[model samples]
Target: MSATPNDPSTPNTPNTPNTPSTPDASYLVDGLRFAFGTLTVVPVRVTRWDREAARGGMLWAPLVGVAVGAAAALCGVVLLALGAGAPLAAVCSVAVPAALTRGLHLDGLADTADGLGSGKPAEDALQIMKRSDIGPFGVVTLVFVLLGQVAALAQAYGDSWARGALAAVVAATAGRLALTSAAPAPVPAAPAPRAPS
Candidate 1:
């Protein structure tokens, strides 16, 4: 006996209510900003340096290596094309990444050497590592490691410039992988999102 309800049909409703129909562009932009900001000396405006952004940055670290490696490879290739010797090309190739990263990894290497050379307790070793001055161990380690890298790269370049470039890419990617894997979890948590300006 109830009156018939008015019938209505709609075909435009989204299957997921809270989700955006289109992909969010901001996240990709943020990830790229964080990646370049954290990994290289390139200038990029990063509005967020939070835990979420750090996680995103970690995911993109390998991409940063791709860029760095490409630049290094190009340098090597150009040197080879210009009839430069393999050793010179190799040295420049090694130098490219160092210049780009501002020798940050070299600093870490020096710190580690200093810490190990101290042979002190963990606290004292850490304190030694924190010093700005390079110790004997650090000096020796840097010389040997850098020489080794140049020698290896020169040998590879002797075989083929392409081989040297490929090696650079692989080494860069592996380095970034190590960095990502060694990062602590939770990323210290991000600060609260700021109010819109």
Candidate 2:
């Protein structure tokens, strides 16, 4: 006897009409969670960690940038409102993004610099990057890069609060957009073959 359509004994066939072939609303939500959970110190619970979720996360990662940028701009604006000097406000603005991201970006930058500066083979460079301690190259890169960011922000703030805030938001958003654009799409896993009935 043939099993009924609603029968529990029926095996699920591949590419069936009942199968969901496209991402649903929940997929987008999962992506959003992944973006915020991984990108910021914001307390978001990511429910999924698979390739589909990662693809979703990458799609939504730019929104995390917008949030970080806005928060950083707010910090600089608030400091300036309290009569803080342009340099001080700039420092706070630059600091906010670093704090929000738990310094991951800066850490990556340092690691990359260390790896490249080693002038080693790919495997050796990767090993250098994986080390816990920062090398001399990492230290120097962090110092110069941070100084440059502070200096640029200070100049913008000196001009006006609006300009400074705009600069902060633009910079942060652009950085994230660059990451998003450069990220490789996750390849979906192939479906397993059905067992012989």
Candidate 3:
């Protein structure tokens, strides 16, 4: 009888040379690229989207926050240097982060609020969130949140420019750090068991 492919009598053919799965960049660089690509309007090319890359990205997310916050702070400081009022500076600072993120963070917040406020079954609530238009709940949430941020920043800026800039940086960094801490790390799947001969 001819030897079967899986039989010990059959010799194994040489396998093709192994290729690298990840890009040439180091793991840390891949993580930074993923973090910036996802979190900001910065034009970073993400080379990997695997679980390992995501894990690294999440860990590096706070750095993106730092950059965004610095930009916001700079806008506020510039406005102040131009002799603009504290409220206007606050508004511009608030707008800078929103613009940099392409309003993604605000959109997510609004969607989440709408979904929770629907008070329907999980499926229905999810559908409400998926709708393109903002709901009443979303509108109210966005208004109040934006108002609160503007007010707080105005107060800080009225006190001192340095205080306002520091607040923006601290708040942005804390928000990103919170998200990173809340996210669950990706777990590897267990290998499947082989059947007995």
lDDT of 1 by residue, 1-197 (tens): 43221112323234422112432466556767998887889988998775445766776788888888888888988999999989998898899999888888899899999999989987788879888999999999999999998898899899999999998888888888776786655442224568999
Candidate 1 error regions (>4 Å): 1-24, 184-197
Backbone-clash count (model 2): 0
Q: Write the per-residue lDDT of candidate 3 for residues 1-197, one digit (tens) a residue.
A: 86643244454444311112333346678778988999899999998886556666887889989999999999999999999999999999899999998999899999989999999987788778888899999999999999999999999999999999998888888888987897675343223567998
lDDT of 1 at 194: 81
Q: Which stretches of candidate 2 lie above 4 Å from their native place?
A: 1-21, 185-197
Index of the highest-TM-score prediction: 2
Cα-based lDDT at residue 173, candidate 1:
80
For lDDT, candidate 1 versus 2, the one ahead is: 2
Error of 2 at 107 (Å): 0.6
For model 3, give the RMSD to the true fold. 9.2
What is candidate 2's lDDT per residue for 156-177, written digit by digit as tens?
A: 9999999999999999998988
In model 1, where is the ten-residue run with the lowest total lDDT? 3-12
Ranking by TM-score: 2, 3, 1
Give per-model TM-scores: 0.79, 0.83, 0.80
Give the whole-model CA lDDT for all candidates, comma-separated: 0.79, 0.85, 0.83
Regions of candidate 3 where Cα sits further than 4 Å from its true position: 1-25, 185-197
